[model samples]
Target: MTASRTTSAPSVDRLAPWGFAAFVEANTHDTAYRPPVVDGPVGPTIVRGGRELVNFASISFLDLERHLPVRRYFAEGALAHGLSTSGSRMTQGICRPHHVLEQTIARHTGKERAISFATGLLANIGFVHAMSSAAHFDAGIEVRNRDTVFVVDRDVHWSIWKGLEGLGYGRNVHAFRHNDVTDLARILGRDRSRKTVVIAESLYSADGTMGPIVEILDACDRHGAISMIDDANGFMVYGPENRPYAREAAAIRERADFVMVSLSKAVGLEGGAIAGPAAAVDAFELLSGTSMFTAAIQPPTAYAAERTIDVLAGTPEIVDDYLAHAARLRRQMHEAGTPTLPTESYMLSVPIGNDAVALQMREWFVEDGYLVPVFSYPAVARNQALLRLFPHAGHTEEQLDGFLRTLATYRQRLGL
Candidate 1:
């Protein structure tokens, strides 16, 4: 072999920047345009950069984060158990509190068992990864990675897609139109040989719309497909009896083969859970890569979540009051001539259509001493930007009144 004429030194060519990273880097030079540094959530408002702004971005729908009892439970648990369990459930992350929380979730949802993950995103990704590959784990058929197909709603939460990221048959994934039972049936009908799993969110938080859950589940059953639901937005609010109070019932919780819940939302705490048949949930305990390799939730959060579930269980009237309050505010929005998407829950979006206009709307909110979340590209389709707002039960009368006035002013000036 001819002695390989090797170059002594490695070439030092700078790597080309990626699209979004380069875009973000170029834009960050504008100091005023960076993300707000929030101090923390206080009641219905947030303290940002030393100023308190009326907050519409918070998902603490029950306003339980400010509840003294919840706080006390969290504090007490932290003091007693220290902070983290410091290991994945496969290792030492397992703890008594985790078991209790899992039991609570299973009982509440009427599922056979439940699994807890560090976050809802993790829970979803892991559940999808593990459950889709599971053999007879309530799918009533054996499925390996190569034999399975995932049929997701077009607007299913991003984490579900992430879960299917590296699977062998991932390219086989098909998306049905959002909330379209006919479209879902067509897709489910196309392939019966492969094991199929249908995925959706019972509440599409971004659009402030409830999914056609009962219809979707009915279709899934008709086509011999299993269903997985992300109940992140509907939890603690949506239930059997016309939940989110008369808007729709979350029949998914009762009907889905699998369900994911984010404690970070209605519970106003940290952590996520996946509940299903005991065999399925147990298989994911080891098969769920996210939960197996990641540290379990902190003890304090588990304590807080448990307490919150109890408190919310006793107070179904709060859910009713919130929808009624949100309905009243939504009416005021119509009177203000602000163009809004048809929303069925306390969450609503003002369709802005253009990215720049939505960003400008955010600046206006900042200037008006309020903070609201806007969805643009990457969050939604291009030119389909919107200012998604939450009407919290905890917002004061003055705050609500001021928010409505600001929206009216913006509508008059920009016609958004």
Candidate 2:
């Protein structure tokens, strides 16, 4: 060639630090492949890459996303409210849709007031930060004095930990054993002089377990501590007569000082709300960093959430139907000798104990026209990986049977 061109290879060091690059490279070759893309609404069955698969990975418990009425409402809201809120609620984003959704959520949850956030994770973080450091942000007073303590359950979601750390109160946070009321009481007894706020979840998503919220709140009352329940997984799914609170809705509303709920799960929308007394809700609206800094939830999502609340209120049987389906599936799994954790809600988790096998089983499930996700290390303990299943109101008996049959065939390979 008369003319030759020389090009130097890109330097890896200039791209990323060695350790970071190595870590990413290792994960790329890891046994577990990341989730695939989906083309449409996530329901009992999902379309992935033009193939339909039995989907157990979705958290849309009621499948309202596919309901004709719900979809119509969503489309109407989109046309009416444009696309985005475009600003924070404190500034220019406050709209009619937001007010309606907030009022609906407050009424549905039986709280004095409710304030919406962009997501459940944001709601939890914002609520904890605002409540724990209210005085500081409001009147230049440090409410989290040396005597204040945050007694949190060990199994509480990571969002709770991030909240504490964000407020620089990580050192003041103490963790009690998971779902152990006795341990919580013991910890509370040791520091009765401090202003303590106890944090726990109503339903833990990972292990498929319900917290002893009644007992935990009672202990908080006896020890002069405030209690907060993150009911993201339990809201609208478990209640009186299998409605919302497992027959203890009234007690929970009365005893828990604060409750956080997610609209993305059973409510079948995309937002979250912190529900409690009017004073706390108002304070969070004013001082919560996330609320003040981030743009409010889109108007379409807010409107959809309001419509979802209306549907749930008008159709009580829907909740009962979901519970029935979940119970039937659990019974079938048990009868088939498949191990499942005892849970009060619709989540069913089967501990697989090995990360590689859990990853392998997920591949088998997908290949067999099913989509069930696996939770491995870093999400859980080192050896406590689990196959998480969510039974929805839209699932049919035939679908459940087919899923169970597939599991039976692969049970030995998964070491279940």
Instruction: Highest lDDT: give the candidate number.
Output: 2
Candidate 1: worst 10 consecutive residues by lDDT?
10-19
lDDT of 1 by residue, 58-137 (tens): 88766764444887888987997778887667766478788889999998877999999989999998887786564444
User: Hey, what RMSD does candidate 2 come out at?
Assistant: 4.4
TM per prediction: 0.89, 0.90
True-vs-predicted CA distance for residue 202, candidate 1, Å: 0.8
User: Measured by TM-score, how close is model 1 to the native structure?
Assistant: 0.89
Give the alpha-carbon lDDT of every model.
Answer: 0.79, 0.81
Model 2 vs. true fold: TM = 0.90
Off by over 4 Å in 1: 1-21, 28-33, 65-68, 133-143, 168-171, 240-250
**What's the CA RMSD for each of the models?**
5.6, 4.4
Give the per-residue Cα lDDT of candidate 2 at 110. Answer: 78
**Candidate 2: clashing residue pairs, number:** 7
